[model samples]
Target: MENLIIYPENQKQLQILKSLLEEMKIKFKSEEQVEELQDWQKEKILKGIKDIKEGKFSSNDDVSQKARECIK
Candidate 1:
């Protein structure tokens, strides 16, 4: 079996898609119905956010320079 993903623009479109899928008897899961994030994933995301708030990240130029140096 193959899986398909769909992104409806607005609530109306989403409702229409859900209705159509129900009419066709096709099973589908919406984003809100998905499982919760794992603890490690959540921790990493929170750490990244904290680092950003603390201004601990490097600039794009610094990253590019490092990349160029590594490529040498």
Candidate 2:
């Protein structure tokens, strides 16, 4: 069986989803119950945040220009 992930925007939506899944007898796990991020994932996220703070990332216009050049 394929797996699916759902993000409920609010507590009401989360409750509704939980209730619906229970009623349907479909097994599912909440975000809190899921495994934590791997070490590499955490490191990559931290590096990205550091890069943003250091202004090491490209701007939207720069990225778009590069994409257009690539497509030419």
Candidate 3:
């Protein structure tokens, strides 16, 4: 069986689509799609959050200053 995805903006539209499908005797399944993150991606995000909490990141001004020094 092939799966088709439908994106309805509101409840009214969803109900209408459901009614249409039912009237036509077409079988359909509605489900929420979830995106799973890779282990490395989760680890990187956690590390970034931890670094922020620990005040371990440089400020934009510091970065700009370093760039200017390098360009000189």
Candidate 4:
């Protein structure tokens, strides 16, 4: 059998999915549930988001050579 990954952003959507799956009698195993963010990761992601929001970003090549796609 193959595996299917289902990701729902919030509790409402997750509850909806649970109801539907229960109604259909589907078998599923939820290993780990997504939870609230940690301070460090949240800060990092927020910084990145703010950078995009404030138009603060680097060109691809500024960070890595591989990102500099070339054609000849």
Candidate 5:
């Protein structure tokens, strides 16, 4: 048995890795790091959630399109 840590940058990458793992039938378990968040970190996360609920977040496609426009 071997243990490895995988830190995916974002949810999309995480999903892709999960799909590949499933396709390959690899046995794996996911564990989120347990840590106490600072007061500021908690506030920031709450604000982000509120913004998402208020439809203030941009989608992946929107960000990618903006990046392409900047590159052009």
Candidate 6:
């Protein structure tokens, strides 16, 4: 892996890399590769949607006080 080096200094280079990596199925093995929030946040949103679907929680007044605080 030490032989691998990425220097995306130009649009052509980037496009070439995008194609080559896509063709080769080369994967990024680095921490920053995750690039966005992890699975827990996605799970929380899914759970909230499921709760709303199931009628498991809440009324407007439950959140209205917090919403009013935003105006202050």
Q: List the residue pairs that clash in candidate 5.
A: none
Clashing pairs in 1: none
RMSD of each: 7.6, 8.3, 9.6, 8.7, 14.1, 11.8
lDDT of 2 by residue, 1-72 (tens): 689889889999999999999999999888679899999999999999999999999999999999999999
Against the true structure, candidate 1 has what lDDT?
0.94
Deviation in angstroms for 23 in model 3? 22
**Which stretches in model 5 have alpha-carbon errors above 4 Å?**
1-34
Residue 30 in model 6: lDDT: 36
Most TM-score-accurate candidate:
2
Model 2 scores worst on lDDT over the 10 consecutive residues at 1-10
Better by lDDT, candidate 6 or 4: 4
Q: Tell me the TM-score of each prediction against the true structure.
A: 0.55, 0.57, 0.49, 0.40, 0.50, 0.38
lDDT of 3 by residue, 1-72 (tens): 777889999999999999999999998777654557899999999999999999999999999999999999
Tens-place lDDT per residue, model 4, 8-55, is 999999899989999999977675654678999999999999999998
The better-scoring model by TM-score among 2 and 5 is: 2
Model 6 lDDT tens row, 1-72: 366768788989877887888889986543356578579998998999999999988788978988889999
Please give the lDDT score for candidate 5: 0.91
Query: How many collisions per candidate?
Result: 0, 0, 0, 0, 0, 0
- Residue 1's lDDT within candidate 4 is 86
RMSD to native, candidate 3 = 9.6
Q: Rate the local accuracy (lDDT) of all candidates.
A: 0.94, 0.94, 0.92, 0.83, 0.91, 0.81
Model 3: which residue pairs collide?
none
